[model samples]
Target: MELTANRSTCIGSGQCVFTDPDAFDQDDDGIVLVLRPQPSAGDELARATEAVQICPSRSLVLSEQSA
Candidate 1:
């Protein structure tokens, strides 16, 4: 799973952080950041997907890159 985030679209709701801190975080300015751009295709995938869905501002996205 590949994770990407748009800091400009974040609302500092911390949903992503709460869902998967291993894959997402908040910067000092309260913007969402992608901590793990490409999480292993494992348990982290589910949490990452939830984080993307729970983002109120739709700042987080996941892509299934062809490997």
Candidate 2:
């Protein structure tokens, strides 16, 4: 899967970063930064999914990678 972050709607809650620091981070203004656009399977994917679900502003998105 691929992850994307919507900076416009982000509230800087840092939930995504907290959930998966390996795949997510925050900029100087606290906007979410996608460190790993395509997370590996297994534990990485699980954490990415959890981060998307727990985002307070719903700024994180997980989508199927294109061929």
Top model by lDDT, which number?
A: 2
TM-scores of the candidates are 0.88, 0.95
lDDT for each residue of candidate 2 in 1-27, tens digit (9 for 90 to 100): 899999999999999888988888889
With a 3 Å backbone cut-off (N, CA, C), the pairs that clash in candidate 1 are none
Q: What is the C-alpha lDDT profile of model 1 across 1-67, one tens digit per residue?
A: 6788888778999999988887787889888888888887678888888888888999888998769
Model 1, which residues run further than 4 Å from truth? none
- The clash tally of candidate 1 reads 0
Candidate 2 global lDDT: 0.92
lDDT of 1 at 6: 83
Q: What TM-score would you give candidate 1 relative to the actual structure?
A: 0.88
By summed lDDT, the worst window of 10 consecutive residues in model 1 runs over 1-10
The backbone clash count of each candidate, in order, is 0, 0
